[model samples]
Target: MGLIVASGLCLALWVVLWCFHIAARDAAMISFSLFLVAAAVRTVGEQVRQSNSREG
Candidate 1:
């Protein structure tokens, strides 16, 4: 849920930057970094959930 929200915000930022023709490269880099972080968190969460389910 949190990841979804963060991703939305990043998308909005990217759009705003694109519309204004501002720091396009920086915006893209930030968005990419956020995506990577979200993916990592999601992967870790899934692994933890699976491990817990197996233990129980």
Candidate 2:
């Protein structure tokens, strides 16, 4: 949830920067967005593993 929220904020900032002609900042926002996505994926994977272990 936190990761998703952060990604959403990053997406907003990216758009804002693009609109204002701030090309350099876009790189940072893009990286942050990617990081958030990776973190979210890892979090989901951990939850799945925990659930599977409990069921097994």
Candidate 3:
């Protein structure tokens, strides 16, 4: 769920930047970076969740 939201937000940001006439390359790069961050966060969250479950 959080991952979905993060991805959506990144996509929205890209769209908004495009609407404002930002360069496509720049906007894509920014959004791609955001998506990578989101993916990393999601991976960390999953690892934490798994560790907690094991400890519990």
Candidate 4:
């Protein structure tokens, strides 16, 4: 589930960047790395929220 959402977000970002031709090779690599980290954070955050909700 998390993988699906994360991949979708990554794909969307790449698509948008390519469409606008704004991201170069180097920028794309950096952007993808940043997006990956952000997605991981998002996944962790969602799990934390769910755990707290269940505990409460």
Candidate 5:
């Protein structure tokens, strides 16, 4: 459940950055990319984990 919420939060962050063009401090700009990567990795990892769990 927490992971699901985090995915939503990443989407909102992206909307703000790309759609609304929110100004973030120079260092914070890295956060947007990190969020995307984290979401993707988390989703892929979860899928792989679940598949492996079900295989046995």
Candidate 6:
């Protein structure tokens, strides 16, 4: 969904900043990464559940 895309973009931005040595503080980046990971996990879980329901 849009959230997944947004999180992915944020992560990409974080990586780019890191490579350029202009990233924010470690805590902020890590927090963003964690939130993105959580969103991804939830999205995947929802997809799987939907697929299983359809199959049933």
Clashing pairs in 3: none
- In candidate 1, stretches whose alpha carbon ends up further than 4 angstroms from where it belongs are 1-22
TM-score of each: 0.60, 0.60, 0.59, 0.54, 0.48, 0.57
TM-score of model number 6? 0.57
**Candidate closer to the true structure by TM-score (higher is better), 2 or 5:** 2
Cα error, candidate 1, residue 30 (Å): 0.2
Once fitted onto the true fold, the runs of candidate 6 whose alpha carbons sit more than 4 angstroms away are: 1-24
Candidate scoring better on lDDT of 4 and 6:
4
lDDT of each: 0.94, 0.93, 0.94, 0.93, 0.85, 0.91
Superposed Cα deviation of residue 18, candidate 5 (Å): 19
The 10-residue segment with the lowest total lDDT in model 1: 17-26
RMSD of each: 17.5, 17.6, 18.3, 19.2, 19.4, 18.5
Question: TM-score for model 5?
Answer: 0.48
Tens digit of lDDT per residue, candidate 5, span 1-56? 99999999999898888754545564477887899999999999999999999996
- Candidate 5 stretches greater than 4 Å from native: 1-28
lDDT per residue (tens digit) for residues 1-56 in model 4: 99999999999999998867754776898999999999999999999999999999
lDDT of model 2 at position 47: 100
Model 4, runs deviating above 4 Å: 1-23
TM-score order, best first, reads: 1, 2, 3, 6, 4, 5
Off by over 4 Å in 3: 1-22
Error of 4 at 42 (Å): 0.6
Quote the positional error of residue 44 for candidate 2 in Å: 0.4
